[model samples]
Target: MGDQIELNRRYIPRLPSQTQTQSKRKGAGARTWLVVSKLGQVSVEELGKQTVMRRTGITAHDLRVVEPELSYPAAVLRRERAVVVNLEHVKAIVTAEEVLVPNPRDPRIASFVYDLEFKLSADFSATMTREKAMEQLPTDTPPEASGSRREAKMRYSKPLPFEFRALEICLQSVCKSLESETSTLEEEAYPTLDQLSAKTSTNNLKRVRVIKGRLVSLTGRVQKVRNEFEHILDDDMDMAQMYLTDKLATLQHEGVSEDEMDDDADVILLGTDINENMSSKCSTLFASDLKPNVEELEMLVGSYFVEIEGILNKLSTEYVHDTEDYINIVLDDKQNQLLRMGLVISTASFMITVAIVAIGFLSINIRIPLFDFGTYTQWYEAFGGCVVCSVFLYIMAVLVFKFLGLLG
Candidate 1:
């Protein structure tokens, strides 16, 4: 019986602790994401890693870059169908038709959502209005009517692709955030630096140190963002891949000829076709080009790059960094002045010590000829002579120090 019990104990599996179970659940948790589309509607949904991969056509490694918990550097990666953005606080996946933002309830991200809805819906409304006007025109219209349409078309500006619009919002939000932070830091930093320069104290030094640290961190982040922009600008192919709408249209045009076999293959194709059909009558619709052009995206990114560069310059060398250098120079000069003053005082102390030693020796009971003169006049003479000798020694020390160029 004992042997059987021992065998049973060894064979049975051990259950994990409650803490371990909870940690596992948290690690593999489902996250909520906000889906914003051209319709100007925002929908909240819970999604897992697998679901995100399936929706975005990205791998697990690419998805990890945008995870909010991870401390990944600024990146703008273009996948086959989506653009992954991880700039500072904005973590999102932008597709040709919509954008998926994680943690939409976050206060930092609220502005992005608002801008996306307002701008995208407004563009869609404008496009719809233009299409409707064109559709109402007569098929056998006269030359004058066509001329009016052409004039109206010329007056209307072209709307950017949906992907570009979403990307633009993200860049704008990041740049705006950076600028606001730089301004706030400047307001606090300049005063602190000025106060420190005027009066060096423990409290003021601490404040300057803290401000400098923050500026350094901010500069690094700005540099990373700028580098990402430059990386995209340098590679034409990378920018070309970012043209999701154009690529979708090209794929759709090809799909009609080859007869896509799988039903799943037609999902994006059908969506693109429906969108193309709706805007076909509009004169400003983006046409399908045989070769992809990146000029549009290049111009967009280049503008933001300039903006970010301005912000970085403010943090790096224009304002805070320059102030720090000036403060250092001021502090060094003050230190030298203090040292010289101390040296002068030390010389005066040495001269006083010699006078004090002579006076002490005469006051002793064993004094000989110096105390022989009993009158108070002799005492006064001795005191005056000590004072005169001390003054002479101090003046000589001052002249020597000045000659050595140590008292400047």
Candidate 2:
């Protein structure tokens, strides 16, 4: 259970430490904390029994939640949950699952499908902003008393310090989850590609579309995540915003000398000795004041983001090839059926031709009863009889073949 929980079932609660001036605050820690390296970014989080693993106000994502509503043993882990962290924007809506529905291209999915899900596309600034004390303040809470918001939802969870090895463990867990899912799909959908039948061609195609569509959606999601991290890494201002806790802390420690209510307030004289330089002191604070090169964070999540994307891409390719194979097999089957029907039709034509040949013999010059031989009237009577007999034999033979189920 612990192993399963760590691989992909782990979730970090939105903590108060993440939003406050101190990473050591009682609660409100960012679910992940980043450490940068030349190789890539690292994310680390510590999980323990007392850790705040579940809560509201943040999305829950993991494998069990993705599977159907069937019961699963409550997952618990004894080790402190530690996962390497980075600021990447890879988020996919939790895909749902349900009872069996055989699809040529995918395994059975959840009966109830959800339409809306958030993407992990937040830029560095937005990501940092989300981690800020100001952002964590509930809408009903005033900015002046923002500390109360952190206090209300505080927890005792520990932060996994930025470490490369720890990050690897976290990433491996995610990879494991993805690998398991891909393997399941291979077993459920890809194996029978060659065995698909003509009767279910349309259904197979529909199922294939569902699977391919999911992969395509995942590709876009992974790309967006990679792009988000890159955007922050390239921009200094974006990086500075990630120091949200520090900036807010600085403002609080300095105390708003200007009108605290309106940051846009014009310079007002608190004392005659005050010079123009002192006016609107808060405005003097700029992105330059916030250091962008904080070694505390590294956005190295793109590597794994792309890796997962590659997996999804590979799955999509397999599905495409399988769909084509199934379709080709179905078409071949239809063609064979058509060929057999053509042979049946030719056989019917031959039977009619034989009947015509047998009737033609009666029209040839020969003696006949109750008529003068070689007279025009006798010849006309023979010709009429020949036509009647030929028509009757052809119709009878067709009816007999149809009745015997041979002409279908």
Winning model by TM-score: 1
TM-scores of all predicted structures:
0.75, 0.36
lDDT by residue for model 1 (217-310), tens: 9888889999999999988767877877665565554442222212222343233321232223111223433344788898999999999999
Global Cα lDDT for candidate 2: 0.39
Q: How much does candidate 2 score in TM-score?
A: 0.36
Which one is best on lDDT? 1
- Per-residue lDDT of candidate 2, residues 138-253 (tens digit): 67867877776666546322222223223333344445555566666666556445334434556666776676565565555445544544554555554343332333334445
Q: Which stretches of candidate 2 lie over 4 Å from their true place?
A: 1-180, 194-236, 249-286, 289-291, 294-298, 319-323, 329-408
lDDT for each candidate structure:
0.73, 0.39
TM-score of 1: 0.75
Runs of candidate 1 exceeding 4 Å displacement? 1-29, 137-148, 156-158, 256-292, 317-322, 352-387
